[model samples]
Target: MESGNSIHQKPVFWQESMPELRPCHNRTVTAQRTYGGISAAERRAGRRAALLDAALEIIGTQGVDKLTVAGLCAQAGLNERYYYEQFTGRDAVLTALFDGIAEELASAIVQALQEVAGGSAADTPSAARENAANPSARRMRPETRTMAHAAVAAGIHVLTDDPRKAQVALAVSASTPELRSRTLQTIASFANLVAARGIDFYALSTPTPDPAIGFRATYLVGGLVQTLTSWLQGDIDMTREQLIDETTDVFVLLGEDLAQRLR
Candidate 1:
């Protein structure tokens, strides 16, 4: 402290006290910045959503052939960097969009079933007790038909609520081998869910190991998809209510018939 050379000396106390002043090559300080009251994460999510929506529009109109990285970014009103931020490629975007639609449809169907089953806390205790006392008798007739109608209506509503989404999910999927494969996988997954739900709802004695349930479930779900696709393409002229009613009839017929066989 007395010599001029002391001015160049390292201050150990200062270094120890202000450790943050040290140069750390590995330390990364990420500053989260917000723009227009929106956080960085929120902005990223919005960009991804915008990209997906743009992908849907392109695929729904010009088909998958037009779904290029450049084209998608242009459609989304985003830079190419933003497209890469969210997806690896055009196929990735397509898959994300399709999966989102499938998830939404699945959720809608499940909610519809729950509503029909009166699973809400708002449901009357008397009604619950009645169903509990004779679940088999209650669930077999009126409950079956009501559940069928609700589920079919809900699924149809989801698809029809956005025809562009329907087009992308149903028609556009068939345009590519990758999407077609995914479509099959999705069908099988939904079929499995249908089989499981049927067994539980009807209390069927049919062993889960049996192939009959799988076969029936696949047939029903696959047929339903085909029927809906036909309707969307205007190949089927019936009204939406007529379609739901008819579909519910088929569901009841097959479900009851299978339940009887399993019993």
Candidate 2:
């Protein structure tokens, strides 16, 4: 038994002197060799991204209810066959669309936080003192704060930047749980950012912080969703900036009311 194990150990020890062959890289290379390549899957994912982009553009132009694969294909510059290759139907595409939108919003939020946290050096003692007292203080620097706001604004623009996408986010909030959750999440995060900057918007502090704050966030977010949808439905006559400004006001009030309720 010892001799048999020693035989295997000799080759294993000798292998340490040569280049290591990781299974993942080895398997990938071997698969490519056996199947003739990486270009296929890479190209496949690219087409899918393009298809989704086209779908978003279509939905932005034509509302969710009217979004069809053929319609998306026409907007995407791909044909029916390509659409079929990537998605089964309008349901599948919408599911993919929600997933994509969620990713974009999440990325914007995370990137804003990361960028703010990574802002440059401060020379003054006051700046250093602020950092020691509250680590995230640097994130509120003029440029950094502007970028953070821009990220949220960009996310808001994602839905509102295009008429069709805005229509979908608002319209489907009630009908689709995923869209509702995503929209609310973005609104809550944006509210938090604005609050941090001392800007007026939803719940600053509260005794029943968990539930009350949550309710406030939902109210503010849901209101925006409803407002945007209504506007798309021609129930409201406000411009995009007007809607965003009103939303900020609603959040500020919600934030203060939440604190009072908590107290």
Question: Top lDDT: which candidate number?
Answer: 1
Residue 208, candidate 2: how far off, in angstroms?
A: 8.6
lDDT of each: 0.71, 0.52
lDDT of 1 by residue, 142-237 (tens): 566666667788989988877778877765457579768878877887787788778888887443446778888889889999999999889999
Off by over 4 Å in 1: 1-26, 119-140, 205-209
Question: Which whole-number lDDT from 0 to 100 does residue 28 have in model 2?
Answer: 32
Instruction: Kindly give the number of clashing pairs for every candidate.
Output: 0, 10
The stretch of ten residues in a row with the least summed lDDT in candidate 1 is 1-10
What local lDDT does model 1 show for residue 163? 75
Alpha carbon lDDT at 143, candidate 2: 37
